[model samples]
Target: MSSDSTKPEEYLSKINEVRTLLGPLPEKSSEFCSDAAIARYLAARNGHVKKATKMLKETLKWRTQYKPEEIRWEEIAREAETGKIYRANYTDKYGRTVLVMRPSSQNTKSYKGQIRFLVYCMENAILNLSDSQEQMVWLIDFHGFNMSHISVKVSRETAHVLQEHYPERLGAAILYNPPKIFEPFYKMVKPFLEPKTCNKVKFVYSDDNLSKKVLEDLFDMEQLEVEFGGKNSDAGFSFEKYAERMREDDLKFFGNTTVTSASALLTNSDSEVSDSENKHLEDKEDEKIKNGTLESSLDTLEKPKPEA
Candidate 1:
């Protein structure tokens, strides 16, 4: 016998090990019976058949061996053409195995649609992508929750037929003035003002009403004015200019440029008048006391002369 040839006893031992781990593989469900299941089955048999703790742990370890770092999008396209299925392992942010399925497709539409759909489906569930070639595959076997349970198989022919009826929506377009960019600015400043006051908050770039709504919900009106310009002028103020203005003055007292200046002038004038009036009143009081003392001294001198 060749040195590499396995003895009958060794072969039997390996088979027994497999049988020991998994209760006999279910005869009816080949699709559902996975390697992890076999490991769990054996672990369960070794202990009380009712308790699955050991089996579950061993199965988890087996599943973790193939965890991948990142998912690739390109390989998923190729697998779709061959009509062969591919599976890969991926890990999520929480460190769970993410098993991904790669569906085979013959056409571009079939492949792209599947890829896009899979990405959308896994957005909330999976942590990272593992591989991408003919078909995009991810590893998601963590905690024995099969992501494929929710997946719907898209055949190539069906994909082609659907692609004809419904043209795919293009990827979101980049805008010079996207509503999202202005949303934060609006939101940060809208709450400080009433609805009537907010109407004055002009939308410079886009007409999207959603942008306006976002601004209304998140921003204080006073803060929003600073974003537009320190003062409403013909030339809009840059952010740096606005910052400089804020640094130079107290923002709380400086709501409107015209009103703030006017208030400061009025306050100074009122303070000066108050000080002058106080001085005049003090001088009059001093004069009255001097007159009273003089009258008392004259009265005392007259009384002494009369006695002499």
Candidate 2:
């Protein structure tokens, strides 16, 4: 593989240091313990080996606890059906995966469910990555999203998960056509994000982002939907179709096992974790978000399956 300018020779040293800190990962976690994986932690820590090692161990423990990769599409189907969040078929000019979210389609009743849904999308995005790309960009379509959709706890937890467990994976996050009311909620969520991560967020007014640099220069118009200035905007994308594709991919990934196991939550007895621990989940908490009633909104949402 060609050298990544963001990762330098010292990255290997940092990786080794963190590896020494965490000890050997399980055979299945080979991907999680690679040189490049450790390099990402180093970058997240600004090359400080000790800090990087600490962060690495914490994230690895979280990974063992969370097992985000193992979450089945079945558990997230209801949220995905809303089409509020999804992995777009196209990549940006730099090959980073593109994720689209419609804040108005917040139909799920549970906060952990929503976070898990987004995590499912993010994990699927990584699974769909080409060898060259390691990051992603989020495009939050704020159209029709009123104040009711904002939740401080959900926002804080989402940002925490991204900054903590999934460090160094966000290439950029662009909020498109945010209404004026979004500012207050956005401000509340800003403090939770890392300074490095906060810098990657961009707010674009429709009038401004309609310019060539966004749709034309940063992305190939033909690869995207026309709503986002791509050719496929008119081509209706269905949750059923996308989920079917994901299921097929999963079949190949799991060697025909349709249902996968849910990740076991953290306990004191886990091998790597038992050595010591800084923190653990207190309890499964739900954020109280008052999303507006879905009246005419169903017209825009995808029905994952006919309710019984």
Candidate 3:
């Protein structure tokens, strides 16, 4: 093997040593990219490029344990700006179909490039959903990738746009392995959503146990019956199972429940408070302008009488 090829293998051995000490990596791994790209990312992090390549290659080799049946790239197609279609095919896992799209040679910017590539694939695949099944759910898993720098409001807006465009046909679930250590921004804006639409939204941690903790903190289990119209008997399900059901059902059953009603009211009240504060500030400014004008007029009247 060439020196370049051998370097990546050397790096892989080092990564394996670290993993052995730390314990096995997470079940889901990062998506595949070129060795050069992987090397660049490693170099940026002061990591050994060869070791990263070796580790990544080992990970890829381990992925074959899942026995993903290879499908033709031509099975899935996307329309070009010139009105032509490009085709690709991905295998099905459980009930979900998975596609792996390689990024263009020009786009070698690492993390950002991967994200952009994934988004592009999702959009193109979404356009072809009509050709597939009607009641399809798209689960885009981002494994431990940090997107904390992206504005939550902007993310929410993008989600809303996707939801509106696809309606029942489209739903996105982000799985952050090792989990992103960021505050829950989705919770703040969730109330702004209509109850009917809110059913479609889910912000979940990859860890089921952590997700359970989040639910307990944010929502009352006993209130699920009174608030969401779900029977208390439903508590028998595991947190992960329950979340899956919620995503699938689109929160339709939750409509007209006490919790949804309360959430809507709270959202309205928050908006009203913001509006009131803004109005009060404007009134103060207007009053100051009027007082200044009055003072100027008084001075003119008092001083000009002698001249007249």
Candidate 4:
């Protein structure tokens, strides 16, 4: 933890100071290493340049050791089979990619396998992002999630990596049907989350209005699974089929393959979606995505950075 000051000028100063501390970063890491990158680290460390610098250095080391960018869908078949996570073809109202995770399907035998799959899902989601999309919306369905699926160490590591290494990649996270027993684990993990990250998290129960509206508004029902309050549930829940569809997502969005149509997704035979799904609703047209803090200057400061 660092100083509590959050003025924009203080942030910029701390950001530059942290840069001076790091001296030289890996050439390849520059894609995510810049002034804006410093801002994320600075904010995460609560305006402490020294601590932010240390965190930045550790992230650079972790990035090299993990080589997260190099992980691909083919390498994480076991995790995929667990059906715990997947990236959707559709985007939220803000055009951010949507990643679905069902903890009930946690069948991975080892922590390594579980962590690898999580990274694979993250990488594929990044790869599938459109040019304008930088962040992602996480839809975590906890229908069958219980003590058996709960790993305190794994949960803490997940929070650490996402906030420290990834930083600012999360747009919003929705927790659907979180059970009563999950409260203790929630308390443990809550302290690790940055205040900003905590604000982005929304707990959605079946009887709640927030849950119904969030699903209907940001996401296309046709693309959502039944358990998550979307239309497709039966055979559509198959991770194997979804994995194959993500390959097409990479081709249509990334460079995996060529699409003849001007609209790659509209004609995606495997998508089983509609043309309307490709359209993004205007920001002003939807109030729910606005986070109800329309006039806050601090919210303005959290605006998306220019992509590297």
Report the poorest 10 consecutive residues by lDDT, candidate 3.
299-308
Tell me the whole-model lDDT of each prediction, alpha carbons only.
0.29, 0.66, 0.32, 0.63
- What is the Cα-based lDDT of residue 229 in candidate 3? 22
Residue 198, candidate 4: Cα error in Å is: 2.2
Collision pairs in model 2: 226-233
Q: Could you arrange the candidates by TM-score from highest to lowest? A: 2, 4, 3, 1
RMSD of each candidate relative to the true structure: 38.4, 10.8, 25.9, 14.7
Q: Compose the digit string of candidate 1's lDDT tens values, residues 87-123.
A: 1222223233222222212233232344433432332
In model 2, where is the ten-residue run with the lowest total lDDT?
A: 278-287
- For model 4, how does the per-residue alpha-carbon lDDT over 145-188 read when each residue is reduced to its tens digit? 76666543355456656766776678788899898776655654
Instruction: List the candidates' TM-scores in order.
Output: 0.15, 0.79, 0.28, 0.70
Off by over 4 Å in 2: 1-5, 8-10, 209-212, 234-236, 262-308
Residue-level lDDT for 208 in candidate 1: 62
TM-score of 3: 0.28
Q: Which structure among the candidates has the greatest TM-score? A: 2
TM-score of 1: 0.15
Highest-lDDT candidate: 2
Pick by TM-score: 1 or 2, better one: 2
TM-score: model 4 vs. ground truth: 0.70
